[model samples]
Target: MSARHAASPGRRDEGRAQPAGGGDGEYTTYYGRPVVKAPPWEVDIPAYMFAGGLAAGSSLLAAGGDLTGRPALRRAGRLTAAGALGFSMVALIHDLGRPERFLNMLRTMKLTSPMSVGTWILSLYGGPAGLAAASEVARWAGLRRGPFRLLAALDRPAGVAAGLTAPPVAAYTAVLLADTATPSWHESYRELPFVFCGSAAAAAGGAAMILAPADQAGPARRLAVGGAVAEVAAEQRMERSMGLTAEPLHHGKAGKLMTAAKYLTAGGAALSLLAGRSRVAAVTAGAALLAGSACTRLGIFEAGIASAEDPKYTVVPQRERLRRGQPVRYEG
Candidate 1:
């Protein structure tokens, strides 16, 4: 009897579990396939994408707030940055196999690991951004006297630091995914940065619209439109570049989500263009853009996970490398 038959509850007379390639050759679940080894990439990558977008958006919001003389946006931007920094730290630590060694990340600064670079960026940016945001809070609380005045003095410099790091925060997550073993991520690197940039801008615009009065949100509406155009263009370029491999973006749940996001983003952008002229339009478009940004992030995450789940993506590329007599490096 086969091992499988022997282990079966009532099949004593059946045969041993035949090897996979036996006459009944078919792929079977590995070792009865308990669902333990779910893809690690999905969890970490999504968190990274969200956190990065939040950071970039917060930075832009702070800068925009300063330019437009909107204290509420400045405060919102700071708080958002602080929250994103905290969440990112949690996600990174959680994703580590040895969560205790999370502190080891600070031991050496390596340029090669995008994770390391990201860690530094978060660490460097978080402090000043938080401080700047806190200053706004202090002023509101009537605590901007004595030593608190030093914090107020530092606010401008901190805001500048946050703004400068914003674009890099948006772009670095793409590098993080690109450096991984996933075929879709690696292939889409060029466009991923632009995609992230758009998402960040949309997020910032949404926050501005929600927090600031309509007149003060005019610049944010413009930013959202610009971001949407860039995102659409980059996605198109990425789809074209991948040719057949880009099927994931056009089929399945990933495809559906991305399509919805595209429509929402385009609609939102169009509305935002005219939103500046009307408070109602601005609010509606801002809400839509926010929803669109969330969908895009979710779609990107799901597509990457799907790409990793299939053996074809992993095996075919390795086979090609072997056929070419090149060393095959396995990525997980």
Candidate 2:
């Protein structure tokens, strides 16, 4: 959304009731205004999304490691989960413009609202992840006496609780994005959750792989490979099924970011397959996967904003659907 994002005022140039938002020479709009206004989000929203997913995945990894007696993996996963969740909260609060706005959201529990559900999801996931991470810190600081002993003893339970809520934490943002009026994002309702989950898993695994011992990083490597595969597949299917709405994802700055995400994810997954013996390979693969996840989130966020700013994406797709005798409902 660079040059194309700017919509200068212009009069209707077509004789038809609605201008040809398609590839015709004529076009129409409310003085070149977008059919649907873009979501008033900035870089913070994408950062929030990426960090939330990473936290969820890391919490799950922590639970797995704790259950399986992998101390290094568990500690690393818990620490990363806690750190990522803190970052996610910061981004969310910054986007909301006031910390109290986020606090006010906790007052209501609207089942049908993604914003409500996502807020509750974050709140619920945070407690357990924080406790688990805190327990690890307590152990490291030799605070296993008095009340600190109780905290350290509850590590497994806290980790398991975090894991229980991880899937929703990883996926709710996709639901929230798709529920919006943005043409590209709304059309991608079906596959976005899978993409988000996959990205989260890859990021968490990659980070843990880089931090944990090579011997205990087997699960992280596997998770990274599996996640990269799922992400690539879901994204491909989503694009293929989106018809006209997929245009934004394949053109301009959004397209370039997505291309980079694809290469990084693929390369990371490939390297992870052979990383079991070499710590250096594991670290490199982990870095690629982390970068890929960031790119994927950023690309999708930019694409949605771009599509929302373009009347062509909004009008042409609905018109095409109507021409095909399909039901088309205006969301706004």
What would the C-alpha RMSD of candidate 2 be, to one decimal place?
3.8
TM-score of every model?
Answer: 0.80, 0.93
For model 2, residues 1-332, the per-residue Cα lDDT tens digits are 22232232332322212444434433445456676778899999999999999999999899999888899999999999999999999999999999999999999999999999999999999999999999999999989889998997887899999999999999999999999989999999999999999999999999999999988888899999999999999999999988888988988999999999999999999999878988889999999999999999999999999898777777678668778999865544
lDDT of each: 0.71, 0.88
Residues 88-187 of candidate 1 have per-residue lDDT tens digits of 7677667775666666787889998998987777767777777877887888888977999899899888888888877888888878877776666766
Provide the lDDT at 280 for model 2: 87
- Name the candidate that leads on lDDT: 2
Residues forming the 10-long window of minimal summed lDDT in candidate 1? 1-10
* Strongest candidate by TM-score: 2
